[model samples]
Every structure is written in C-alpha cells, then in structure tokens.
Target: MRKLIAAGAAAVALAAPAGAEFASDPAQHLMRIERDALETVSRDRLQRLMRAAAEADEDVVRVSYDGDWLAGQAAPDGGAEWKCLSEALYFEARGESVRGQFAVAEVILNRVESSVFPDTVCGVIEQGTGELYQCQFTYTCDGAAETIHEPEAWAQVGKVARAMIDGAPRALTDGATHYHTKHVSPRWAGVYPRTATIGVHHFYRKPVRVSSN
Candidate 1:
C-alpha cells in the first residue's frame, strides 16, 4: 500500500505541470509558442476583437494606444507597420472617434495615390521641409516625437491599421480625401461629396466628373 501511494503521488506531481499548461488561455499559449517558434500570427485575430470593441462591445480584451498599458499585452513584434500607424493615430487623434481615425488613415493613403506626394505611407508622413509644414501629415512636421501614452487606444488602432494595410475594404470613407468633426465644417466640404458620417467626424470625397467631349 505504501509503494502504491508513493507511485500515485509521483504520477500526480508529473501531471500537475501538464494540467497547468493546458489550463492557460489558448490564445496566449499559442501566441507564446508562435513567438518562440518565430512564426507570424495573423493580425486578424486581434483585429476582429478590436472591431467588436469599436462597436461598443467591451467584453473583449481592452486595448489602448498607450504603451504603458500594453506592458504585458500580446506579442510585441507582431506587425510592426500596423503598430507604427496605430501609435501615430493614437497620438494624433485619440480624442476623435474611430471613424475619424479611419478618415485620417484614408487621407494618408490618398496622398500616396496623388502625384504630389510620396508613394509610401512612411515617406509621405516624414516628407517635409525645414522650418515649414511641407509634409502631408501635420504631426510629422510639428516636431512631436510619436509616442503612445494610451495602451487601449493603441491596441485598437493597431488592429485597425493592420486591417487597412491588409486590404480590408475602405468602404466607410468612399475614397475620402478629408474629414472633420461635425462641430466644425471645413470650407472644402461644399465642393466634395459627403460619403460617410462616422462617430463625430464627417467624411468627404472629391467629386469625380465624367467629361463629355
């Protein structure tokens, strides 16, 4: 009986670690394994959760633009560009609504398409002249070091940025070139078509006319 009890105790001890490992959050466990394996986890998993949060469903893990809040958040190195853009948007327009943030991204992409601006987002954002706001984004020229203070906002923004970069349809903006909060309307609104009103901001697109010769 003593030998049998000892064998049972040994088995329990061996099984404890495996049970603990299995009890861990599946998403987190997979993430850790992926990180150790150098495998890239799809950003979609986080993006879907973010979209749900944006729609006011907060049961999902709360993310923010502040780096401090994300100290123990998910994989840090996942999607660098997405993280960069998200941090930029957080610092630039955290006060604005989600739609406003998307509009800001649209404007950056629009500049990429225009002949007057650089071809890439980083290029367009960083393009500027000395002592002047020559760049497409004022933040890049305003001499403010891009830093994330709100982790939840940054995480959500990271999801949005990742979705946008991955060719998720830009259906909300309708190719909008500009947007502003409903509290104030820009003069250019009169010349453009109002495409969408999301959150506090109204999105406008440049009207395209088909010429008849």
Candidate 2:
C-alpha cells in the first residue's frame, strides 16, 4: 500500500505541467500534492477493482432462456469441443425452443460429467461413430451428410452451446444424460428415469444401481 501511494504521488507530480505551481507556501504546496496523490491512488484502486469485477463476470455464464439475450450475444466460435457441441445442437435440436436448445446442451454436458459416458464434449457426442444404428446420437450414425444449411438457426444454437460449455447451470434437465425425441420411444427410455420433458424431447437420467452386499 505504501508503494502504491508513493507511485501515485510520483505520477501526480510528473503529470503536472512544467511551469505549474501548487502554492507559494511550502505547507500549502505539500497539502495540494498530498490531496492530488490521494485522488490518484483512489482512481487507481477503483480501476483495479473494476477490472477484477469484469474478469469474474466473464467466468460466469448467466442462464437465461430468453431469445433476445441469446441473439444479442456476439457470434461465438471456439475449439474442436465447442464446434462439436455447436454441431450437435445444430443437427439435433436447432428447431427446438431456446429453452429446449439449452436443455439439450445441458444433457450433453451432463454426459461429460457422468462416469458412464465419455468425459469430453466431442467424445460424448461421437461415442458411437461409423456404425449404423449403433451410435449414441443418431445424427452421427445416420449416414447422411451433416450439412449446416441454415445459418441463422446454426448461429442461435451455437450461442446455446457456447453458454453450456462456459458453465451455464443445467437446471432444466435435472442432471439428465440421455434424451430422445418424443416421437420415438427407445428401449432405454423405458428403463431410464424420466427427469424432464422439454419441447419435443424427453430427458432422462440413468437410475443409480444399488450394490447389494
């Protein structure tokens, strides 16, 4: 703190014009210098505080289902993990509502957290590749080219994926790691405990197996 005050005092002294005078009296000159130094110190402290706040805010991804909030966010692009998540949302849940899209993203992230699924976003999404009807996500095994034809929808879902990847709360899905569209009742859906029904998808979490002695 003393160093900071000394630095502040030096800065204020150096910032003054070449011919500027604080006061004729030595006492008053010292008083003016001290006041200016204190003000500079306060401003410097405030700037540091503001920068810390901004950095903390950047770490938190506010969970909001509002379309306006998502649309207002800048276009997001990231590494392979982010791209895989964005593509998953684009192909699997682009048509879903903003809340639904977030829900789907939550499921993917929840899978990453689960011991049963792969730990990474890309790994989780591509768990079963190159095998028709054997992949976890149908789009990967469907054999059809994963072409992104709709830029607007892609952008929207990309925002959702980015938020989820940035640690948005997965409250909508209740820690669900599996989801299937309502039109199809997969064999696993019958056994997994249904946690959430959002938009056209049914979200589920695998039941915990109790080990008996």
Q: How does model 1 score by TM-score?
A: 0.51
Instruction: Please give, for residues 128-195, the per-residue lDDT of candidate 2 as tens digits.
Output: 89899799888999999999999999999888888888788888989898899888988999899999
Candidate achieving the largest lDDT: 2
- Poorly placed runs, candidate 1 (over 4 Å): 1-84, 114-116, 127-134, 183-187, 207-213
The number of clashing residue pairs in each candidate reads: 13, 0
Candidate 1 residues 1-213, lDDT tens each?
Answer: 657655555555555566676344444454455476554334665777788777865333443433444344443334545655666577666776665666677766776676666777666656773455665456666776666677777766665565556554455677776676688766888888888887777778766566798
Spell out the clash pairs found in candidate 2: none
The TM-scores, one per candidate, come to: 0.51, 0.72
